[model samples]
Target: MNPNTTVALPQRGPAEHDRREQIIKAANEHFRHYGYSKTSVAELGKSIGVSSAYIYKFFESKQAIGEAVCAQYLGHIDATLFAIADNGQSATSRLRNVFKSLMKKGLELFFEERKLHDIAAVAAANRWCAATNHRAALYGIIERIIVEGREAGEFERKTPLDEVCMAILSAMTPFSHPLMLEQKTPEELEERVVAITNLVLRSLAC
Candidate 1:
């Protein structure tokens, strides 16, 4: 064999990719219905008609599967905020949509899919740092909106970017925290979210 020879490694075929997706989908349903911790990798494989070893070929462990499920949950949200950030709307307008979408998603997940919500909560509790990173990725979208506002002369840089990001996340705690906001009526929640959005905009005024 010549040392200088370039080997052409095989790319993953569509069939294998499809199988992997099937596994993740099955894992999510198991987590959403039976709870994440309660679903073993073997159980997941059994449900999919595959062996646990086959499951391992896709995901190393139950924890990995849980993380994948959480990713699936966040994907829709990230796409929503991604669109908001990319739009030509004013920063204030984008911020309103951002918060509105987040609160709506929270209500749907917390009420309609309580077991899935529990899986996310348990994952965060067990892996605090990774969970923080997941939240940070979303917060970074807000930070990008703030930067745009500053550049467009609609907002003042009253504080550092990181501080501003944290402040926005802090202000949105009620909307993001399902337990606290769950008690409020729909009308009450809307009123609170609208009021806070206005307040946040005022603070960012130039």
Candidate 2:
């Protein structure tokens, strides 16, 4: 971790933990409503009915608060992947399920928090390589699934497993882009995800 990173020290008591969670939630709402650059500590404190100093007790700075919000968002993605891994499905099926879940969650985030999603999208476009590697751990899980599937003779692709993982991730990127948010129902989005996932699976599956 960077020296500048203010680690969220684990809260000891119930009240303390609740307060910290409340501050983080308030910050997330503020960031979602007004983009990261526009959200102020004072505005966040006012929304949470606390003084700016009190907010600082839980979070060190606006950038720290932004990191917390991003961590929470990515944490959700991690949980979904873990759930799929625990579903007792074959490796191929697990990979498909994970991608579908990810796409569904992306759509939810894109539509429900358009401003925050837009901010993240712009950041990603500007730092595509770093953003891509930032999620390397998650992609590693998919690569392991591909390797397992290949060993089981379930996926016949001769391309390297890492390449296959990248292809799967690439297929899901459209769901996260702002362009996809125009005039699309949840069901339609879900169908599109399912179709794309199936196509990738077909191309790779034995």
Q: Per-model C-alpha lDDT, please?
A: 0.74, 0.67
TM-score of each: 0.81, 0.68
What stretches of model 2 exceed 4 Å from their correct place?
A: 1-23, 32-38, 45-61, 126-134, 177-188
Q: Global lDDT for candidate 2?
A: 0.67
**TM-score winner:** 1
Q: What is the C-alpha RMSD of each candidate to the true structure, in Å?
A: 8.1, 5.8
| lDDT score, candidate 1, position 153 | 90
- Which residue pairs clash within candidate 2? none
lDDT of 1 by residue, 99-146 (tens): 888788877877889888776566556643334555665687788899
**lDDT comparing candidate 1 with the true structure:** 0.74
Instruction: List candidate 1 segments past 4 Å from native.
Output: 1-16, 128-130, 178-187
Q: What is the lDDT of residue 104 in candidate 1?
A: 84
Q: List the lowest-lDDT window of 10 residues for candidate 2.
A: 2-11
Tens-digit per-residue lDDT, 1-206, candidate 2 = 32112334232334357667877798788777778788888998888788988877766666556665665675677677877866767987898788777767777777788766665565455543223333553565677677778877888867876667777767766664445444577788778878988898889867
Residue pairs of candidate 1 with colliding backbone atoms = none
